[model samples]
Target: MRYLPLTDSDRGDMLATIGVSDIDDLFVDVPAEARLSGPIEGLPTHASEMAVEKHMRRLSKKNLAAADAAFFCGAGAYRHHVPATVDHIIQRGEFLTAYTPYQPEIAQGTLQMLFEFQSQVAKLYGCAVANASMYDGSTACWEAVAMAGRVTKKKRVVLSGALHPHYAEVVKTMAKFTEDEIAGGLPSMQGSPDDAGLIERIDENTSCVVVQYPDILGRISDLTEIADAAHKKGALLIVVNTEPVALGAIKAPGEMGADIVVGEGQSIGVGLQFGGPYLGLFAVRDPKHVRQMPGRLCGETVDAEGKRGFVLTLSTREQHIRREKATSNICTNSGLCALAFSVHMTLLGEKGLRTLAAENHRLACLAADKLDAIPGVRVLNDAFFNEFTVVLERDARELVRDLAEDDILAGVSLGRLFPHEEALSGGLLVAVTETASEEDIDALCSAISENMA
Candidate 1:
């Protein structure tokens, strides 16, 4: 029997108690133009669960999933192999059912996991400390910029043209409400930010200089020069990583003296569940800037008994206590995902992770070699980790669509992300993971060759 927790009368009574005539009044703040006039046009108003499931399955069958095709798409999110054990452990009733550990006494297990996760992230990025987790890489990036502004007490932020467009936009949106200035929304470098151009843009007014590792087109740069340039101008250097796996092979941003490091941790212990429920990894050098870092941090401390224990420390600086004076308003942490990431990292260990990253790079290089052999395709970047961009002879959007028709889930077309950049509109970014087999790469290469011919 179905349980009706709230009947129509109950809803009406609640609405009346709140001085609202109907439930729709609650949504009055939403613009009338934005509101749906009726139920979705083609969908049925109601259906039995079984019927809905069948219909959904039918609809799902019309599209190709990563497993169903030679998938190469990875602009930010990646398709990686998640071990069966990760799901099994995370689904434990104790861990899955628990909420935020506001009380450290009862939340020892949860808090400990976060502490470990933070430690792992700090080590991975070669930073002093890391928070539990943020919403995703993009938001973490925004928070990093805000933190830089606070620490430097400067208004201007220099964003590399090589930064991801979506990430750059998010930072810009946040800057709008702040007193900070953002300079250089330059075009993406496809491989790395134009270091020379970024260096040129830095000035005394700049608080931080931001650049991406293996940037939008998957090009890696030794930020020592850029970091030195920013530091010379009394500006902090913020490094972004859309793909965390690259860190295994490439130099850590912190090693090059990045004041702050932020990245998407989806490649590790996270699945590309259609772009979301991903983890954000943020780390910073040990300094006063720690107070400006967003999100909650779990610290290890001894209890009255002198045994090992975990507790929430430095919370007085958060939004609830500090109000407008708080460093950030981010109240929630990506707990479960963070736990999953911790578990995955623990299982992989340092050696396993590095091997996995090497495999991904190897496979990607192989795929790039094959694709570049195609008559109309030319690999753009000479240096990349697991992803690279290819310039197509024809429109990249059309090529992607044509390849998809053959059950090949090709790379992301540059036109899809940057519509106005004529030079890049015909480029497509392709990625390869350890999950992609040699056969998959060969199939994708064959599809592109046939299409181009």
Candidate 2:
């Protein structure tokens, strides 16, 4: 009662006022399986603080630690070297303790950093402008589609098979409420890096075509033709990215005429943290659509004394009047995470990022070559940045499990993401980065070869 500070009578009155029979009504929108059953597993209703800490530590150890294992894990998130300076700066009490910059005068520091983050992100995507941030890569994908719908006044979105299925699912979850049509989810496995006929699927009803840059399987393409095709149909090109570092070496999506670009910025200053609290980057090539973009935007200006200052700008229309017409329901940016990303990108600079991108490409190529040497495996991508998929003779999930037993993560299985797709049964999505050493690649190659044999 002390912790809850709410009595049974209070809860009943609150529920009754809301016209609900019980608290269960609150979770009506959540899927049943996703809801808690009675209580969480192994966690007692009451436990000592020390006991709870110990239990959580032990449970955490059961996971395959990314640091200890031959970690090749990448479908969307990736492993990259983050400088110690990045962490130190983000933790400064002034930055870490601060909340969203509600007032421009007192929150100048945060606003300035966000302005820098938006600039770096826009440059990376080669877009005219970018928002302060979004939730993460996947949710950004949803916002991109919804923004496209707003901009074009259309109801259909055509997704490429190459887009990350997780991102597509996020878009689908939001689509449940709208009349929007989400077309194409089948993965383009083990074929030409280009979509077979994805561009041809675009039509008058289409608002945007969502395509992944260097795709989920780590396949790379020019995207010029797809952009041209989408433009011809009066639809915008929405490019989804999971990794921002690829921009260092590949052609920028904005340069390719992509109207909107969004992706995860975790590969920069942020660690995997097992999945979330990752940064979402959003950018648009057209200045006309800036008002439709989600989250916050920062701008630069001069003060009364003509000194430089920063301010929060370009909030979605929904932030003001017409609650139902809100351009974005995302309340605020991933401020801390965005700061981390900006710090990391600043440290990398242009030359350093290019060097890092090149190293990652080299390492991935080496990994792909080594994996292809295995008798039962074939590297799928003709060109890639850091991550790529391989077609294996055996079940990918089984192979990953067997290698896990040998202290190797091996790779993610395509079957897990596309359980019903018989075509993806033996596919493995392996990721390589600058962090992977020659020994790591060799160990994974040996483990996979021995496991297959």
Cα lDDT of model 2 by residue, 1-453, tens digit: 235788999999999999999788899889988988687788757877788799999999888787788889899899998999999999999999998887778889998999888989999999999989888999999999999998999989999987888888888888989879989767666546555488879999899999998788888888888889999999999998898889999999999999999999999999989888998999999888888787778899888899899987655464665476778777867899999999999999999999999999999989999889889999888888898899999899888988898788877899877787888988999989888889999999988888886
For model 1, how does the per-residue alpha-carbon lDDT over 113-229 read when each residue is reduced to its tens digit? 999999999999989999999999999999999888778889898898778888988998989898567775646535445788789989999999989887887777688999899
Number of the predicted model whose lDDT against the real structure is largest: 2
RMSD of each: 5.0, 6.8
Show pairs that collide, candidate 1.
155-181, 161-186, 161-187, 190-217, 191-219, 214-219
Off by over 4 Å in 2: 1-55, 320-322
Q: How accurate locally, in lDDT, is each candidate? A: 0.86, 0.88
Query: Worst lDDT window (10 residues) for model 2?
Result: 313-322
The alpha-carbon deviation from the true structure for residue 150 of candidate 1, after best TM-score superposition, in angstroms, is 0.7
